[model samples]
Target: MTGVLIPGPGKRVTLRDVALEAGVSIKTVSRVVNGEPAVNAATAVRVAGVVERLGYRPNELARSLKG
Candidate 1:
């Protein structure tokens, strides 16, 4: 039997990618993903835009620990 070859890195979108796209830090991306308060409205919107564009989903296990 032959197996199929997957193209590119098979994995989920990471926080680092979101941060880079949003021009912010990983912590800012984390803040947006986790729905944390105190983040500036503008910054949150920018981060959210990046997250949506990249279809980035936070790692639940990691997010839980941060809270």
Candidate 2:
């Protein structure tokens, strides 16, 4: 059963990683991910690009808490 070890479901790209990749802060990533009005359009685009590249998925439970 030996094979290449793949990152299983337990592995996830967090907001911190997105922020780091986008050269922004965690709060900025959170704001962009949540579609907050405060985020600049350009910044949002940048964050979104990083999110897509990194395959970052926000946690639904955390999203609900913001509502």
Candidate 3:
């Protein structure tokens, strides 16, 4: 898959992009995206906003590998 973080015509946005845009660590973005407990609600909300704005989506293959 392409490494592009900004989704455009046929491009897939990534977690790293969300983190960078959200001004948080990648792990924090992961936690927020995965619905993991312990993330601050405010932070999660911020990350979610960035995700929506950036059109970010988790790579399913990488997600499965993480599990």
Cα lDDT computed for each candidate against the true fold: 0.76, 0.80, 0.80
What is candidate 2's lDDT per residue for 1-67, written digit by digit as tens?
1221333577988887777778888999989987898988999998898888778887889778987
Q: What does candidate 1's lDDT look like per residue over 1-67, in tens digits?
A: 1121222467777888777777888998888887999799999998898788777876789858987
lDDT of 3 by residue, 1-67 (tens): 1233565687777778788788888999989988998799899998898888887877889878987
TM per prediction: 0.72, 0.74, 0.76
Order of all candidates by TM-score, from best down to worst? 3, 2, 1
Q: Residue 28 of model 3: what lDDT?
A: 97
After superposition of all CA atoms, the RMSD between model 3 and the true structure is 5.0
Largest lDDT belongs to which candidate?
Answer: 3
Identify the superior model by lDDT, candidate 1 or candidate 2. Answer: 2
- Steric clash pairs (candidate 3): none
Please list the residue runs of candidate 3 whose C-alpha ends up more than 4 Å from where it truly belongs after superposition.
Answer: 1-8
